[model samples]
Target: MDHRLSPAATARFILLLAIVLFLGGCRFLPWRSSPAPRPGHGLQDGKTAGHGEEPRIVFEEPDLPQPAGEVATPARKRACGSPPPPGRRLPQVAIIIDDMGYHRRIGGQLLNLDMELTFSFLPGAPFTPELEEHAYQLGRDILVHLPMEAKDPKWDPGPGKLLLSYSPERLRTTVRKDLAAVPHAIGANNHMGSRFTEDRRAMRTVLGELKKRDFFFIDSYTTAASTGMEEAAALGMKTGRRNVFLDNVHSRDKICNQIGQLIALAEKRGWAIGIGHPNQATLEALTRCRKRLLRQVRVVGVHNLVR
Candidate 1:
């Protein structure tokens, strides 16, 4: 209340004013921490977004239909390959187990299924050579799972991948090396070419190399924007596009449903190709569905479907 205060009082007032001012100014600071997102809010599916971070986009091709619900599996796994009833011309469906060579045990199990499942080997995977040889011996159709740049950089397609920035020569060289890594490969398919396959020029370069070797191309069709199937056809190369992705969900029920979907698609279109991974769920699903599959349609090699 006095005009002037003692030093102690003045010091106390100054300190209080300073503390208030500091607290008030914090709201204007550029680095103010954001409130943590409530659980089940903000970032989802274990994805993060920070400065300069592009939001992730997960693409599901239109052809890949999600299952309505969990499919019921039988207690006893019925034998899969019962020769199609005589005199019935069943539609052909090709099942390609992609991402092979990495999972030796699962791949071996898949090979034993007697479904004539095609095996697509990753060129740089450690078990590729041995598994490729084994698949060849088993008379399974082989494909080079050619790595290519995915739309999401977070998804690594593995080594020796063809990129959109590559020169034609570089793309050709990389493709050749990738194909060489897998012996007995009658053709090649995109492992994850969401981005690379969308670039027509780049795809032409990659497909051109495959054309020279007389190898077919199967577009995994990771993206709807992909020009791989179109470009390959324009080059007069035998080509097929995947109709269904069998195990994107990795549930045995889901995969069995997808296989059912694949067979239905083939019956409608005369032929259909379903691509899956060397996953245990997929192997089990195929084994479980074997009899129903053989009875419904002819399971052929992927090469047979590519045209």
Candidate 2:
């Protein structure tokens, strides 16, 4: 109990105790170094604690408000400047019966088909006016099936000749004569203009005349390189082209196949125009398929469907 230490030894012991207190009080002292894993999450460094692998953290973004006056209005009112009626859908099938003035029996058969058809009459036929009037009276549209020169000389459309060699004035005169021949015609489509339709100048002249008369143009599309559409668009005319020819083969089976193709095109494009002659076979096939076709899509006049 009476043991005492030297002054130097006591001083050394006191210095060691002071050093330990200083280390404990220091806030910035370096401790065991680690990366400080994100707040309360566990590291998935090849450890299997749960049934499956640990769920990864997904950072969520905050919601942002749209700028002032940048909202989109409903499209119906903006383009036409008025809202369209709710229940109306565009017609799908526009059936046009071309070359209607030559044969009375075929024309009569078309009349008895009992569907809304657009009849295009050949100019200067003996029964042009009569057939046009009959078609109109029977609630069908009338179109002037203008005769233009085709690639083959043997296949003539009809009276009026729309040759490619004619000057602009001559072409205009011929078109006027053709239009005058077929009275009460609402629109015009080429009869057989595979050669003439490819001529841009002739097509422009025809389209210009049609535009002046305020008629729609329907390109028959006999050839793949048709400039009729481009010319009509340039002339600012309401126009469309035939998507299907129902009687290209003049057989019942082939015509039915073409009709099926027409239906498919209508389904794909929302509207399709089909042109056909008033042949007996075509008429019979159309009559047989009219009811079933109408159930799937509306069959309307060509003018009613095209804009």
Candidate 3:
């Protein structure tokens, strides 16, 4: 108990104690990361529904496919919405732009055109109010492009489409509701009524309602079998039939060519009606063909051609 260590031995003992202290103080590095993920499972991307609840799996949506083509310019954007500047009737021609309200830029571009054209809006669309207001501000003639059943078995005519399955009363109610949706709507046209427009009974029910409201009808003539115009006339409601589909092919060349034909027809018959969509191709065609259209015949609103 009283034995003293030699100086060298004591020095060696102290060095050993320092080495132990330094080794014991050092642990894992500060920059060390967590454990590697287990195979086939991640660190739960989802949270528990509540306390003591199992976590639910969260899925990230796959990217949707892009549309086939991008429309740089709308197919038609004719300067629209008025009659020939007073005293210039000049064998009127009216262009009607259908399928409005779905696309914002196209609709606005169509409105921007300085020509007098009609805009037919789709009721119940998300942009219905905005489109109606813009068209209204520009004093454009607004028409409700009423959706109707087509001959195709699988084609979806979209919301508010008229079905042959509807009874007369049901049809009337639906028509009224649609017409009311677009304030200042002077008339309506069928969206795709190849089958419904051909049924005389259905046309009568539809025409009868239009007659009651003093609204005009424009038969899109989606099919040659359509009797929509005849029934409207039978009911004594003012009506018009599509003379030419301006952009059936949805190309600038085809649409402009169609517009040329429309002008010639207008000169011959005193009036012509052309229907087109709010597309880049149609817009380009109409814009390019503006001067020729003005010289060949007067471009008037759809209402001017109703008679």
Q: Choose the strongest candidate by TM-score.
A: 1
For all candidates in order, the CA lDDT equals 0.76, 0.70, 0.73
Please provide, for model 1 over 96-120, each residue's C-alpha lDDT reduced to its tens digit, 9 standing for 90 to 100: 8887765667777788887788989
Better of 1 and 3 by lDDT: 1
Q: How many backbone clashes does candidate 3 have?
A: 19
Task: Point out where model 2 deviates above 4 Å.
Answer: 1-91
Better of 1 and 3 by TM-score: 1
What shift in Å separates residue 211 of candidate 2 from its native position after superposition? 1.2
Q: Would you estimate the TM-scores of all the predictions? A: 0.73, 0.69, 0.70
lDDT of 3 by residue, 1-307 (tens): 8699999999999999999987777764464455533321221222223454322211111121111221122224323223346666678888999877665666688888989989998776656789889889899888998878767644445567688999999999988887888877889998767778889998898778778778999987777677888888888888888877777676898877778667656756688788888778988988887876786577788888775
Whole-model lDDT, model 3: 0.73
lDDT of 2 at 188: 91
Model 1 segments beyond 4 Å from truth?
A: 1-86
Of the pair 1 and 2, which is ahead by lDDT?
A: 1
Better lDDT candidate (2, 3): 3
